[model samples]
Target: MTAEKEPHLSVARTATSPSAVQVVDLFCGVGGLTRGLEDSGINVVAGLDSDADCEYAYSVNNDARFVHANLLETSSDEIESMWSAGAVRVLVGCAPCQPYSKYSRGTSKEDPSAPVLRFAKYVDDLRPAVVSMENVPAVSRHPAFNGFLETLASAGYHISWETLPASGFGVPQTRKRLVLMASRLAPIALPASNVAKAKTVRQAIGRLVPISAGEANKVDPTHRASALSAVNLERIRNSRPGGTWRDWPDDLRAACHKGESGATFPAVYGRMEWDVPAPTVTTQFFGYGNGRFGHPVQDRAISLREGALLQTFPQDYKFEKAETLRSFALVGRHIGNAVPVALAKQIGNAINSHLEKYI
Candidate 1:
């Protein structure tokens, strides 16, 4: 985190009419954080991201402006301009977590220009009243994350951070993430998980009309599965819920599975158990062999809508692009990359509660 000079602007001069809390979601992909905060009664002014593919989904699904601008190129002054004059300004973001993902172990390090570092620029320049960020757990160990916290601390921000399991907050998926919250107004912290038992795969998507492999639901196109090869189709049919490739018959087992090294990847080519929360939904979740994404009873990988539901997006949540192509590759990435709405809502609730004292 390099030192960047704060923009020479008076808060009073730039202030506009205030109603409640106003937020600017940086690196806001498809407006997941915006939607969750909005559901908690916060006013989100806009979403800023570099991907044009996200424009329609962000604008259509949430009542906020979606600006397709790269964060590294966009200055903090331009960003602070979106803040409401009188409202409590909240800056929230979830930088792309690929750099810090466990899967990147052997891969080359993330580029220096990754969004994770760029978002810190806004924090240094604007110094909003409240800030929230979410990222992969691996990030907490990175020097960049430590530098980010140091920047916040030096700026007089009080911060609280935790590695939380999304399932603890009723996300219906065993997705774990690092959530950080900071405030200049007063001391703030995340709320305790209110959900006692984790939501199950069946509880989340049982109501949806079931579909088979390579078929699309007539009512909702997003409720569609990817076409599987004949061999993969047979593999899935022979697979039992919660069981792995170990269950496959000798003839059906892949050559890799017979090797000693195959034991290392036990979760692959497995079906999710109906009574348990799903494994973390990833960008390739639409593929049957990607993690344990297979439908518990249905002989297919979970549908796009089911994947989104596991992420806790609303049933009617609009993905403008899904209407036409219904391309599994495209829609899967959209749904998988999203933050769980339920978990985000809880974070919003914590922020709202933390601010009530100053309000």
Candidate 2:
């Protein structure tokens, strides 16, 4: 593996022309990373994912085509064909992190390494001028990550990676991610946190008018909150910011919380503090019992639109249209799983700076 150097400012701050770059995002859930890359002036040609449902949001919000193919089933030629003849092919992805994420239990029987290894093999075959990946920090400890490292080094690419806190960049959540960048053109490294002060949850979603549980704002369908049962409603009423289930009257606490094992899971069923960054947006951020997702003042979990905002997705960024109904699980999954747009923009800017100097 290539020895990693400390991150430094890119050699040049100027961005190359957008036509000179072509990016293909693999396993793109709903185009979060691609949106940010486009905002940073990179041209994302298309996003490939196994979920056909992502077509609407990915294409509508990004103006990028969506390819419905399993990453494992895709070929190097298929992806390479999307590239412009003389442009810098920038390949990027965040493989599913279920195997390595501390937040999830197993969901699929497929080999966890299959996607990462396949992506690494693509980099080897195409030898794209630039490559980028983002995933839960735990992925760095997995053997698949090591294999990815070896593939890049053997391919003569200069590689660097770092554990970055999304809040430090611009996102208003405390999600930490493992980000890796590789380049055949130059030795590239991630930039330092450019924002002077971390943005808080209030700053991200405070302006939206409050809604009760089971209510959807008349103006924005995505601003709807999931309904809570009577008992769960009282439980949320009792909870405080960053508080655990222990505050609930014994009757309101779940049976799971009565045992000794409950001590280890204190981060759940709590409201977010308004002053600090919100807890990491998860796939179930709409559920009151899931993590510290409850709104600090509102007696309900954060809404889908709020979750997207906390992830730094633009306010006007569309997640659903006339054809797409409001489904929390579906839209929440897209918002939660998406890379924070601000963070991706930072990465894209760094790469553009590298290209300006080297190419």
**lDDT accuracy of residue 349 in candidate 2:** 93
TM-score, model 2 to reference? 0.93
The local distance difference test score of model 1 is 0.82
RMSD value for candidate 2: 7.4
Q: How do the predictions measure up, each by TM-score?
A: 0.92, 0.93
Residues 1-359, model 2: lDDT tens digits: 01212222111122254448888898988889999899889888778888877777787788556777877977788887777777778999999887777778457788888989999999999999999999999989989999999999999999999999998899898899999999998899785699888899999999998999999887887888999999889999999888889888888888889889987888788999998999899888999888899999999999989999999988877788734665898898888889999999998898899888888
lDDT of 1 at 192: 74
Which consecutive 10 residues in model 1 have the weakest lDDT in total? 1-10
Error of 2 at 283 (Å): 0.8
Per-candidate alpha-carbon RMSD to the true structure: 5.6, 7.4
